[model samples]
Target: MTDTLKIALAQLNPTMGDIAGNLALLRKARAEAAARGADLVIASEMVITGYPTEDLVLKPMFLEAAESALQALALDTADGGPGMIVGGPWRQDPTARPPLYGKVYNTAYVLDGGKVTTHRTKHDLPNYGVFDEKRVFGAGPLPGPVNFRDVRLGVMVCEDMWKPDVSECLEESGAEILIVINGSPYELDKTEERIQLAVQRVNETSLPVIYVNQVGGQDELVFDGASFILNEDNGLACQLPAFEEALEVTEWYRGPAGWTCNPAHREAPAGGMEPIYGALMLGLRDYVNKNRFPGVIIGLSGGIDSALTAAVAVDALGPQRVHTVMMPSPYTSQESLDDAAEAAQLMGIGIDSVSIEPAMQAFNTMLQPILNGAAAETNAGDTTEENIQARSRGLTLMAISNKLGYMVLSTGNKSEVSVGYATLYGDMVGGFNVLKDLYKMMVFDLARWRNQVLPKGALGPAGRAIPERIITKPPSAELKPDQKDEDSLPPYAVLDDILKCLIEGEESVDAIVARGHDRELVNRVWRMLELAEYKRRQACPGVKITRRAFGKDRRYPITNAFRGPA
Candidate 1:
């Protein structure tokens, strides 16, 4: 065996369903590694098909196209560049018995000298939390090590590294180094967990490890590609940055003990709102770009939720790609109007004024009987009028979305979404929501954070995208005169904490109340949260920054009846 070996870790962004574009990215990384004299260029899992292909794996034509792309990549290795390791769906053995026939496995191809030298399928098909691998692809066999020129390398796919048995079997089967390819998505503290998991494996097998992950947004998911290398002693050797594509060659030297990776610069992972902001940007960017939406249209109210959503939209897609509309009612405060205009100017996004008063009057004329007979109201009218105005705004936004190709961006925060504080066809109408999982308190925090610094990939001006007045002002729906959010809900500070414990921490009402909260309020918030399950179930998909988001991470049935303690 050679004393020295070089492996290129390609942490990259992949567009879902673009087989050709994905292959081009892989080839480009391959050329870069070849230029650096690396022996093998390793890419993330399902690099050719993007990730979480969902039900697309069930299509026959897509699988054929993906296989064709893989073949093309293998043939390209004929030019004598560094060999390629690419991930995609490969059909199971045709000679196998009935049920297994025509099945596809989440397979990785090892290509060199114009041929696929070897292929290994992923053993642990992850089925939980944003993964539905078991539904689409069949499980692969326990993988053994592959013989490279000098090293017997144990190759594992994304979920394979998460479990212990796979790595144990690989070590016992004569694998030298553990090289894992991943399409791991980003969560609050996942990067740290990944490192510790890798460390655990290294301690068990007495072998070095290299982890390469895919970066970029895929629908509701964002993959933070902070790949790393760890020595046999569980020491971190090399680290890559998160939320972006990176290609780095790691030098390994085999000795009497084992392979020790040469130390490289370890970038501190992004902290505080930086990582959260990055996840939002990448998630929105990929969702817009990959889905081929012309741009995004946001109903820019003077409220914090709308302001932050607009800011994220501008950061994700340039100002030119984000269009804003201000649908104002009679109750729309002058302060809100001025704040919305100021935000538009600061962010350099165009804003149009669309009055919802006419539609509101029309709705009132139609619903007069119900309002007169069955509603209690002040001089301004009742909740029926409020809902009409909201629904009118929703109609105007949807019309704009249909006229132009811009997707509507919803601005409801998790606090409001959790308690059903939003109108169904009104403020909740949007193709996607950038902050569906963020609590109201977190929204203010991120907005403040954005104003303080020009985050990377921000398309707006350097100053504040969220105006000071907007941030400082009391939040309201402005449906009725002098209406405030606090009229219906508790302060965001109290509400968000209760939500974090109940939704994320899954704590009981008594447990949350033990932290000095009103038992009555805790029970009330829990009821609202439980009752709003249907709304959340129908809400547009959003980026997840917290540990347990409202989407896949936290799945409560709309028909759920269980409630916390009184």
Candidate 2:
């Protein structure tokens, strides 16, 4: 039995469905770890086929491809380099008949001595909110510890470590060290929760736990690679940085007491708005780059939503790849125009000024005679005209996007989206929405936070990507003369609080009223939130930052009639 061990945690980013590319990345990480004198390398869950493959795991050809890649990786250990523990989908019974053809488990393979020595499957399959693993993958049996080079290594998948059963089984079966490979996605303040859970397991087993998580964007989910290690004493031994790919080699030695880790690199956990901003930046970057978009185009309306979107785009794709345009109507103020121009210059991106007055006038003239006929007189209102202006700008952005091959980035936030305040095809038209899950108040808070400090690995300017005036000014859509968002909706501070209760809290109308909101206003906000489900259903995908993001986290019926307590 060995008394000393060297294992490397490989925190990496894997693109979904790119088997060859992911294998190359893993090979590179293994080489780097081998050079550091690591005896074994542990990668995040599903590094070969990417995490949450969804229905792709159901495909026979895809599974075969993944198995092939895993075999090829197993062969790489023949050079007497570091062995690897990699996660992938494995057919539980490959020789089973037709009905069991696609039955696969989320399995981790232990590769050494030119072959896969043994494998462990995940016992728990997550089913709620952004996870539907139960539908795609079968639950694995509770596993015993994996014997690696005479050391008893307790191996668990992502959710397996969340509870005590798997760890208990491993410990009872003679596990000396606990190693968990994960594809855990990022949510606000979730890092602390993960650490707390690890501590709980450590307290239970008195065994050091090493957690490895992937980093990158997959659809709306963004994984932060805050992989870490906790000693038997429940103290942090190592921590990889969040939102960045890194590899750390940890040395473990068995003492008279038990296994102990030599304290290694521990990056200070990201706090405050740092992780939030990193999530947004990395989410946008991976989405654009992975989907092969040349760049992003934003409709910079001199509003907080659009301004923040532009800043994020600049930081994500660099100034050369980001483009902005100002589509002004007759009611567009000179201050707004100047602000848009200044913000564009500050971010060092090109801005084009395009007036939508022509489209507005044409639509009005075309509809005037029909309305003058008296049949449509009752239906005509200022809202129709305002929406026309919004649609005209949307059309302008789409036209530019078509010509330049750049994706149009929508700028509406959760507050506007939740209340049906945003025009559907107008402000909501985009291939992606960076602020889709963020509220208006969060938009303001992030804008202020971003200006004060340059985020790590930011491609934008050092300070003040947004002008101070833009933040302090009252938010307006500029669709009508002297228009402000408050004209139709409640104050953002109050509205966002109510929304948090309704969307994230899922509190009933009366429960929300108990939180010091007007009863009638609470009911009204709930009504608006329910009515806007259709729009949200059709909205583009954005980063998932909150515990209850709109898309996969909160799934409400669009055509429902369930009015809670009056």
lDDT of 2 by residue, 50-151 (tens): 987988888778888999999999999989999999999999766543343237899889999899999999999999999989887888999999889999
Off by over 4 Å in 2: 95-102, 369-380
lDDT of 2 at 350: 90
Cα RMSD, each candidate: 2.2, 1.9
lDDT of prediction 2: 0.91
- Tens-digit per-residue lDDT, 1-566, candidate 1: 57888889999898989999999999899988989998889998999998988778777778878989998999988997778787888886533433432287888888888888999999999877667788878889999998877688899998899889889999999998999999999988899999989998998899999999999998788999999999998888889999888899888888889778999757888788999999999999888888899999999998999999999999888999999999999899999999999999989999999998878776766666765633322225667678888889999999999999899999999899999999998899998899987889889999999999888766767877889999998999999989999999999999999989988888987788899999999999999999998888888998877777887777888887787432
* Decoy 2 TM-score against native: 0.97
Using lDDT, give the best candidate's number: 2
lDDT of 1: 0.88
